[model samples]
Target: MSAKVINITMNGLPMEVYEGMNVLEAARIMGIDIPTLCYDEGLSSYGACRLCIVEIGPQDRTKVVSSCTYRCEEGLEIRTHSKRVMDTRKMILELLVCSTPGSKTIQDLAAAHGVITARFKPEHEDCMLCGLCVRMCKEQMMATAIDFAGRGPDRRITTPFDEASALCRHCGGCMFICPACSSRCMGPDADTTLCSSCLNLSPSCVEVYDHQQCWMPPGCGTCIRPEGDYLPATGRISEVKTEA
Candidate 1:
């Protein structure tokens, strides 16, 4: 038998959706926009980025939950843009902005919420730890070269044991999937504003870019290299050799 449809109230608007449909999907179907950075339709819901959080339950006692992974239920009452939901999202965006002040993506997201500056001292980190690249590497691309390391304040994304792994296929999936760090690359043909300081000095390159290629000789015209060689964003010497 086919699954039964479920009725729910989102932002005071009644709607019907499939029994197992997630709250995010239901909201989208009803034209409710829920901001999300970590929830990609092509990949599993990791819930690492809490930007898509929504307020649930009756007004008396509502709680916040990640709407992307939360399944809809009969008579469920959800508020996608309630004051509480917007406050929580603003707080989350503030934290992300403090860590990644230089990230254009994060900055733009923060600007949308009217957050000019983070109250917390900026940690100067670029990666928002959204885990999209890591999940994409493990589930979609199947490279499994990088993962979360450390705990608490020191926690960060890195290749296994904080070193480049031999398993990386240089598919550039990690860079392509990263929302914050991937903004550096404009595509293969278009030049990017990438600099050697970002490429060699920062951990953002190792975490977001394919780790194997970050340590290799840099020749991409996007940055100033020692040899002045112009290469593609993939940082593949093979491409330079083949073209020559």
Candidate 2:
């Protein structure tokens, strides 16, 4: 059976999309840009990062919904860039920066949204708690090696018991899927042992600390590039491209 289609109005423009599709996918099909952090088409819509939020409703009543996970409905009205939506997005970015000021991903996103600084004290950590790595590990790799632990501000991503688990495939999938980890190892740190290529014995080494471009040198260790589509800095793997 064919899937049903949904008709929606976005920013005064009317469009038709597939039923059961999320607002983000519908918006992208219409060329509307909705910034996101924890969204990947290959994984479940976790909605952990509220950056892709959009306002949805009628003239008198509307509410903000995470576009990545909010399924589209017929006769739905969406406002992607209203004052309320932008304000919410800005605040979300501010909080993300406060949590991970050292992350270039967060920094770049905040700058783009004119979030000059965080209102809260910044944590020195790089992980953004996006849950992409955790999703990939469990769903795709079936490793279930890492997950979010703790609660409130104490929550963080880590291996079980904070120790390396034997269930870890060591496939470097978590490092590759992480937005913070992508540019984290670009430098020649005193602790070179922390490098993924060094730890995995992969020949492809990325100079993340190089400051200009994240360059990957060949022949240091095996390099695994994501298949199907290519992304610049994030390097997230949607599908398995190669193993060597």
Using TM-score as the measure, the top candidate is 1
Q: How much is 110 displaced in model 2, in angstroms?
A: 1.1
Model 2 lDDT tens row, 47-140:
9989999999996899999999899889999999999999999999888867654345666677788887567765545567899989999988
Residue 41 lDDT, candidate 1, scale 0-100: 92
**Prediction-by-prediction clash tally:** 0, 10
Most accurate candidate by lDDT: 1
Candidate 1 Cα outliers beyond 4 Å, as residue runs: 184-203, 206-244
State candidate 2's TM-score.
Answer: 0.74
lDDT, residue 99, candidate 2? 66
lDDT of candidate 1 over 72-117, digit per residue (tens): 9999999998898888899998887676654546656777887765
Backbone-clash count (model 1): 0
In order, the Cα lDDT scores of the candidates are 0.71, 0.69
- Model 2 regions lying over 4 Å from their true place: 185-244
